[model samples]
Target: MNKLLIVGISGVTNGGKSTLALKLKELWTISSIIHIDELTKPMNKLKYDSILDYHNWDEVETYDWERIKKEVTISSQNLLNSSRQLACLLNFYNLHEHHPILFIEGILLFNSPIDEIFDIRIFFTLDKEECWKRRKERVYEPPEPPGYFEKYCWPLYMFYKSELENKIKVDSSKSSNIPYNINFIKGDKAIDETLLWANKEIYTHLLNY
Candidate 1:
């Protein structure tokens, strides 16, 4: 069945998921994008000098997952899928008439129950050093105090990233891989070149439509 496509854009704080979502919205007039950060419950602002040597950045409790799922369901045309729906993505649909494309973006988009609903998953990453430097240039509302990146953000990102890599280790023994619409985007790469590659990937997926 032709269906609404849910796109997941995920990455650590300041990893450029928001920018990409905005651009994708611009590219597809029929698309809608949601930022989970906007729906997160307010928390005490981070302190400039507070140092936590270790923190579990993969904690799903940090986000309001229930509300996110509700909002996505309300906004989407959500066609019913079979109970035996494939556990893995077979492909993606880039466009459809009755069903609008939805892009859900957040730091832990993949960690929530909502993740399994996405037809496409895009991960954005930059070098650890680059992410640290960029954190200083970016500002969070309610305003994080100085040195927050050095104290918490950068370290947690790198740590969780390493863990994720270990979990997704490729199986060289398999003759064919399960089809999954996952893409890794390098933020430090040239924007023009990166967008071109992304466009091509989406275009290829659209061919299936």
Candidate 2:
């Protein structure tokens, strides 16, 4: 049996990480697909309105850091709870004597403690302007406001990238300049094209190893 894990990372907003993950799911016979966005839904719902209000640093700072930390802590707890649910699902699959390739996709997958779990990591790189533009175009509902990216997500992502680059060997040959990255060919290319490439890579690295 062949087993593999894919972790996708990129800058804060939209860089097509989710799109690529979904595409990979379509291409591969993945036993389990774990998306961190799904895990963070509860936290988003809880802080949605508040986060919307705090679009700028001035507004975010108006609230005490301790209070913000409390909210974040609660959200972190929710993340952990969701992680447990996913873990149970994985364990169930494992116990059945069936080992299937798993693809766990997320923005922060390579950030901090979580990175230790994935066997392979891929980053989607895009310039800040391109990222923000893609995000704005994708927004069906209006986001908090301008400058939200800089005020919130960018700093966290910078910290994550800095730490991640130090931890793993990056494939600099790939166009995506993401910290530790692999470029999975995408776009209007035939599905077979992508699958052929991926299958070859997987067997060469995972099966041979």
Top candidate, metric TM-score: 1
Q: How many Å off is the CA of 82 in candidate 2?
A: 22
Q: lDDT (CA) for every model shown?
A: 0.64, 0.48
Q: Model 2 reaches what TM-score against the true structure?
A: 0.56
Query: Candidate 2 lDDT, tens digit per residue, 25-87?
Result: 555433445555444332233334355564222122222334433443454454445445555
Each candidate structure's TM-score, on Cα atoms with residue i matched to residue i, is: 0.73, 0.56
- On residues 46-93, what C-alpha lDDT tens digit does candidate 1 reach at each position? 222335322323345656778888889876643324211321253443
Model 2 misplaced regions, further than 4 Å: 1-12, 41-52, 55-99, 140-142, 168-200
RMSD, model 1, all Cα superposed? 7.0
Q: After superposition, how far is residue 64 of candidate 2 from its true place, in Å?
A: 22
